[model samples]
Target: MASVARQARSAPAPALLSIGQVLAKLSPEFPDLTPSKLRFLEERKLVAPARTASGYRKFSSADMERLRFVLTMQRDHYLPLKVIRGYLEEMDAGRTPELPGGAVAAASMLSAERKLTRDELIREAGASPMLLGDAISSSLIVASDVFGEDSLAVLKSLVELQRSGIEPRHLRGFRAAAERELGLIESALMPVARRKDASSRARAAEMAREIAGQLEIVRSSLIRSALSRLDS
Candidate 1:
């Protein structure tokens, strides 16, 4: 054990990372993490990376972990920046603060979603470029250089549907239906949005998710009921 400890102590420390390096390392999990976004987070003081002799940003391993925590909280819980900062401040003061989303484990602090490039997405989803083109043109999917996990899932389902001879063209009405549902959600949120507080905005976002979930349930039930009539 002492020999192992000695070897561990002799190990090299993690290298400090540059901003571009940080983005490249993290963008797979946080596809939206551009340099501008990182700068914005730094401006908000959510993270405090060190500076090199020439003033370049240098991020230590601890800084990377802190950033992962902050981004996970923002992405998963939709916590306001002030709230996240306050939690971090509590931790810095040596107090164990509760996580905003009732998180029970440290793993919850590292909720990075999957990200894929356009070609990678197609390969992973078993989809053809023509299908992707049709999906985009029909508004079934938005064209992007990088896609989130949801986009991959959608494309995979489309691939299965394609095998069954159901094409993206057949799903064109989905976009209009989704837009109408979004309109409803927007109308519902306007009152809360007008309040202009961070708390209000957070609440509105949560409520909007809940309402969208309910709308999805209703839509699913309607489709199932219509299918039941055909079976009858």
Candidate 2:
């Protein structure tokens, strides 16, 4: 079997992938990918496609697959680009990078996992119906038939907050604050999000989520640091 890189080099080069063609191939899996976002990924050195004699970019099947892997890791694992790049570099060096156990299996599991019914979510978080209602009313958890990992994380926080009498209503401002932060991210990604390609749009969304997750981590760390000062 031809190596993925070799196959990419041997594939017939298109005249150029009109931003449209790129989206058609990549969008089903990555619905939010856009042309500018693709360029942004290039700028970050996550992907390097071949340039035409006239400077037009021409991606290969291999490039597409590589991109799929990279985007999937960022979206599902919350991995930063630097860490993802390191993993790719290991693969490029002819070593099979050891993914976390059942990583591939886990990818398939996400949709089902995200389909947690209301009762299931309450059970998982050990939360009561009243608490769940408060969470939804406060916008800390969006009302949905099925809940994703994001909802679960919020539920976990609510469980902790319950102990301190910080009910869901008390954290309603958190939802508003998150929206404000998201607005900043959307503004930064405006140029990229304007493109019509699905892959680029998907990649942009994944990038936004990754950045938001990082911000949440930083915010948590700062709060913990401040609390330690009080303890001292």
TM-scores, all candidates, are: 0.55, 0.59
lDDT of 2 at 137: 94
Distance (Å) between predicted and true CA of 70, model 1? 13
lDDT for every model? 0.81, 0.76
lDDT of candidate 2 over 94-185, digit per residue (tens) = 99876522464346435523568999899999899899999999988889889976687689789988998898888878888988898988
Predicted candidate 1 versus true structure: per-residue lDDT over 1-232, tens digit per residue: 9999999999998799999999888887777677767776787788999998899999998989888887777665556677778888999999999876564224455444667898999999999999888988998878888887667778999999999999999999999988999999999999898997555665675567667757866988999999999999
- Winning candidate number (TM-score): 2
Over all chains combined, what TM-score does candidate 1 have?
Answer: 0.55
Clash list (residue pairs), candidate 1: none
Error of 2 at 136 (Å): 0.5
* TM-score, model 2 to reference: 0.59
